[model samples]
Target: MEDIIDKRMVDQSEMSYTVDILNKGVGQVAKKLLEESSELAFASVEQKSTADIVHEAADLIFHFLIMLKATGLTLNDVSEELESRHKN
Candidate 1:
């Protein structure tokens, strides 16, 4: 049986980060996201190990999702945007 409950667990983690970031204010969340993004890009450009790059990318995405949630946006908004662009 395919377990469909994984999304909820992932969302709970995201929600916890969102709440923590929002408590510190949007600026903190934005700063963290920028840091994560820079690290990910740097790792990719520098030809880092695959595992290292993957770790950095995950941090970037987690922070990005926090920023999105802090700004009252959901992952669905991004998905919809990408989907719309695909249709175009």
Candidate 2:
């Protein structure tokens, strides 16, 4: 799945696509993530199982990567920031 995502991202990048396309894609992904997160939050309030929360969290992370790619950033950049923050 990651490989497929990477390939699509590379193809999009190589095509010199417009920022609008990226923005739209990111916006949609953000909406989905927000919805999922809200559901997860509500589930927490209702004392739902950890498994459900974990599943939603994973969905959020996956969408986050799509958002990052849409913004022309790579996972490596995010990883580097996390590493730097860890050092601090």
Top model number, TM-score: 1
The residue-by-residue lDDT of candidate 1 on 1-88, one tens digit each, is 0121234334666565445566787899889988999999999999999999999998888777767766777778989999999898
Tell me the spans in candidate 1 whose CA falls farther than 4 Å from its real position. 1-18
The CA lDDT of each predicted structure is: 0.75, 0.69
Q: Of the candidates shown, which would achieve the greatest lDDT relative to the real structure?
A: 1
Q: Which residue pairs in candidate 1 collide?
A: none
Report residue 24 deviation for candidate 2 (angstroms).
Answer: 4.4
Q: List the residue pairs that clash in candidate 2.
A: none
